[model samples]
Target: MKRLGLILLLLIGGFSVKASYKQDTTIVEFTDRGVKKRVTVYTSSKKDFELPRNLNLENVLRSMGVDSSERKKALVLIEQNGAKQDTILLLANDGRTVKIVAKDARDQLSRRDTLRNDSDHWSRSGRNNDDDEDDDDTTTYVKPKKKNSGGRFFSKSDFGFYLGLNNWANGASTVPSLQTWGSRFIALSFRRNATLINGKQMDLALSYGPEISWNNFMFEGNDYIDRSTEQVEFLVATKDLNKSKLVETSLNLPVMFNFGFEEAKLKIGIGGYVGYRVGSYRKLKYSDSRRKEINRDNFGLNDFRYGLTVEIGRRRGISFFGRYDMGDLFKSGQKNAAGLQAWTIGIRL
Candidate 1:
């Protein structure tokens, strides 16, 4: 199952493109009041391009005498070409004046059938030289390229943390699961992934965090005590208390399978998580000496739980998500085991 998830994640992560280049160009096509236009420009290689600052399409059209009304309604098309290419801009209106320049020898010749005699003569001589050398070096040779995964889909993600308000319900309000109670708790978590198995899109990961929670409960086997009536019944009284606050810290391991659409920019996935409670905060806090609160540290909490997780993200930068704990956090007979289920809301970071 874990291997399956790892495969899913890697497969989903494989589609996003990440390449480095120094130069690029922008191609723009515009239609103003039914007029079509196009232009291209070449630029120096750089990591990022500043929009408008480098080339102002609006200003260019205005300089060409295009009317203000036509400019406002113009439909624009923009394409990012690598630094090696020229930025292309087009304006259909006669009002707009566009400066056209040749990017290379081919571009210069594209508009004319005229050929440079010297270049043609030089090409013929070069071809003759190539034929003589080709036979001399009969060893068909090629340079080998370095094999690298390169930084593709995800290099890293941001940290995420969240809490759920309605975790459980019982009698009057009970949630589906081992425990039941209307409660609120917070889950602070950190997640990371690794591609362990080959030929699969599943990823293995770890997440752990602490939580603070509050809930009401009636202890098993104890005489029911009603603080409202200031009465302790020997046989039928029910144990009644306002609420209890507890702390839980756990370590979780989850295996997930992911699937992506449109180059892994959009994704959806489902997986399961296993957890171990490393610490707990269950001691009661009281302000007065007249009514002493009891501690059930030795009787409650199983310390282990498991659940399923759903994830979605747009590359490694932006993600939104949720998680649900499906397993019990109690031993067979612990008193506090009655309430331990939790929920989480955090980012993919």
Candidate 2:
């Protein structure tokens, strides 16, 4: 009984001394539009001074020369960082300075080690764990477990844009008069990729996607695709023209098989695509006051075409892609640009 009394007296004396030292520690609390909130702020003020518990929020803000909106924002900041050591408000006292810090600014080991089955958890300094030492802030060792029996999805998906150059490919001759710079190719593609063969040295993946592509073949000078001659002919206009081109849009499905070199951080893929022409037209812009003219027609272009695609880049990021048409760009019996096929090279995002 005598020993218990002595321990109680010592604990009470320690608490009293601590309270005396903390009496001058003015904490800046947060108040939101007349509603009192709890946000602890340690301030560096004069040792003899003690801030009031219910300081007039409006008057205190007015003295700081802050407007009404700013006061609301400050309150919001405090509210968002509730019960956290958000920051320090420094009053002119000695050589003290304010310090702003994160609320749960515990050591970094408190974070979860997110990996496969070997993920180990770390406990914070003050957190009570099931271990023998309640105050130990060390990492809790976790044994590695067997991989999941069901397995994980080899999932990777993307929606990306491609922009670059376009041209025609034919075995007989070339459309050399086409403007290289103005013949722009654009495509929008959405794809899902999955691991086909996951191995130690290399990995293989299969990607299948839907693509919408546009080809603009801006011809040079007066050259235009003339459909009125019963065939698609790139004829020079007699009327000094300003602009002439043929536009084709298609909906395509592309399938690619990719090989990934893990250490090299490179992925190379080859595949094929099949597409149907959705829309086609020819436009003529006159230099004089004849006004811009547009003709909506197939212009002897084939309705369906299949092509080969090749991709190269990192597994995920801006990559390079190229496609070449294996079928005719024009119908087989069209007699004009019949063998011309479309091919494009561009960067994919």
Alpha-carbon local distance difference test for all models: 0.36, 0.61
Pick the TM-score winner: 2
Q: Write the per-residue lDDT of candidate 2 for residues 234-257, one digit (tens) a residue.
A: 677889778888999999999988
Q: Candidates' TM-scores?
A: 0.41, 0.57
Q: RMSD for all candidates, in order, please.
A: 18.1, 18.9
Model 2 segments more than 4 A misplaced: 1-154, 171-176
- Residue-level lDDT for 46 in candidate 2: 40
Model 1: lDDT of residue 197:
29
- Which lDDT value does model 1 have at 242? 36
